[model samples]
Target: MADGHHWNIVKIPPIVQELAAGVHEPPSQYMVGEKDRPAIAGSDMPEPIPVVDLSRLFASNGYGNDMVVSEKQILNWCDRDVLREYTVRCREITSLVLKKLAKLLGLSEGYLVDMFDEKAMTYARFNYYPRCPRPDNVFGLKPHSDASVITIVAIDDSVSGLQLLRQGVWYDVPIVPNALLINVGDGIEIMSNGLFKGPGHRVVTNAESERVSLAMFYTLDPEKELEPVPELVDDEKRPRQYVKVKTKDYVTGLFETLARGTRVIDTVKISDNLNEIVS
Candidate 1:
């Protein structure tokens, strides 16, 4: 008899084992573009950012209080060391997630493990535009999909503003208390051979309150070449699309696009020399 639910205890991975075990650091300042940014929501709104506890993310798997992550710590991720530690934790959790997804997809566990090892990870913060006298005039965040493998988000539960693009329509994603939202990033789609999709999403701000979210980005390994898995490619009128790329060069290309403030994925440079993977 199966209850249809799989369970496993989770713990901090060895990559971040040293960092999380070290002394704590002071909180750093966090802000959006400016202090007096115009409002994106209407004047009647309160703060839109919600609160979440990522410390308990693996609690169900028995990691419990042994792993504690504070909201303030995530808010100040300017420290590269802190960001690195957070990224490691992100990959650790995502490894579990990828395994589960692989099982469902009938893919081998080794494949999933390899995918995790070949991935790059990073941590970033999304700050809601500050409250202005007028809300409709401002946009806290524009809709976009992360250009990575997977994205784990610990959002502020008190404020509700994250929306997902579904069937070409925007739908509000309710931020339940104490829950983290897992969204498939572009890389996952490529790895999964398009089985899982990276949907477009965005955040709206409250006229009087600020909204914040911490995003963990997991990327493909820079030394590896990425192409659609043959097993996942089936005949469907859609053409079999594959782009070869080196993960390091791919990421550098991504930063170049970000510097230009462009959201077009097509503009990203893919390495034709993807076969040059180093051992």
Candidate 2:
């Protein structure tokens, strides 16, 4: 079993931290002193969070060793070598974690890996939350479930604010220095036939200290079909709890629904009787 302390040795690269500090975006709605600022759509926030698409670093063959960034600003500030090294390390970690998850779910070690094609998408976001005047009234981020297969979050251990909702209650996620937080996303829930739930989580703001976190999300090939594994579904025992859909379509719906303040997962969920009949 892997404990939080076990990941304490994996530190965030200094260049990544430097880039995060240099990339400034407009204040988010959650900040109390930003009342004078005009509200903007979540997607069009004045200062957009900096995101690096690791997939873009690869060539058409998907095995190229060279790394490149299309954004001039990012390219100028980031160290390409360091970025490549970090991306490679994160990819390896993701593969190992997926294999372990497969074993725990009684599936072949490569089962989940196959779902992620050579063109599988990997994204990293650098989140910087400024200190808020009234932390009690605002949240750093809204409550929502991740859309990827899995997410790895590395937080600035000096400050603590992450929380997850479980069984009608919200629990604080402890901050462990150098520790990585693993979150099961919606795709995993669909692939696992609802056996592994993607919990809803949110971030709270602090009155005194600002917070920084780096999150990497791993997703399957968009063109691939997403459905429950047959091995986990029995005609009479376990049933397929979600309808089959393309990964891209599911993700599109997820975002569309989120924009409307609703969840799309339930919309595709198979009802008890329907699930049994389909199985």
Candidate 3:
């Protein structure tokens, strides 16, 4: 994809350490001087939350043939629904995304979750990091990937804090005014036999402002149970690449792995010579 002109990595301000605490820690948490500044909204405060629209989802193709919506539009819709109606819409979108991904990866429509033996759905989470008095001392969030099949993120353009790890370099992701970030998760990777890539991302604190972010996660039901699909394994290809396992077992295993100091997800076995990620 050609990079958008509007997207560019800006240098972090040099004076961030001296003026006030960074965005990671809220100013309300710590008292620095004789008199704490009264909290004021909109005085110079940027809107941390992003505003998204989802009308493009209902659009039909011209003559009902050549019409197709952009990927960003679907992401926007996913983000918007999560912000509005908590979980119902998320589940609907999750089903849709899984269906599309399954078709792309050559699985039966609705068979993606079946292979993993889980009920898939979507969810939205909001994160707001207000400015702090000590910007250099704290971080808004540590780098991590979503525990789901996919994660769609929409960040506030007013204040920047999102960053990504690429080739051992930390690059700030440009927060497009109304655009969304689509990232695949470990589950999709295992299901696709490693076709998609999950992003390694983290958030930082701004010295002068606050940052708001919304992330939509797609996942599977804890009880539906899962197993690796046989179609993904081939004798000519990577046969021992993964293991078959239940969805619930996989989710628990992932958390355990994290606690044990592993960031990248590994394969879990479902059946003989079949492995997959359970997210």
Best by TM-score: 2
> Which lDDT tens digits does candidate 3 get at residues 1-279?
376557668885555434434333455534323332221211211333333343344345344734124554445465565366745554455556667688887888887655434445555677877675565545576556656777777679788777666665566665567666667787776666566556666666666776778788777776654333568766566553445455567667766765444564554533443433322
On lDDT, the candidate that comes out on top is 2
Candidate 3 — what's its lDDT?
0.58
Candidate 2: minimum summed lDDT over ten consecutive residues — where?
A: 36-45
Candidate RMSDs in order: 16.6, 15.7, 16.7
Error of 3 at 52 (Å): 14
**TM-scores, all models, native as reference:** 0.60, 0.72, 0.60
Decide which is better by lDDT, 1 or 3.
Answer: 1
How well is each residue in 1-279 modelled by candidate 2, as lDDT tens digits?
366454446675575436545534424643334442212212222332344343443335755464324754554556768756777788777777787789889999988877777879887887887766656656677667888898988888898777776775666776666667778888889888889998887778766678999888888888887788888877677777898888789778877877665677787799986965666
Q: Which 10 successive residues of model 3 have the least lDDT summed?
A: 36-45
Model 3 TM-score, 2 decimals: 0.60
Poorly placed runs, candidate 3 (over 4 Å)? 1-59, 62-93, 108-110, 113-122, 225-227, 249-261, 267-279
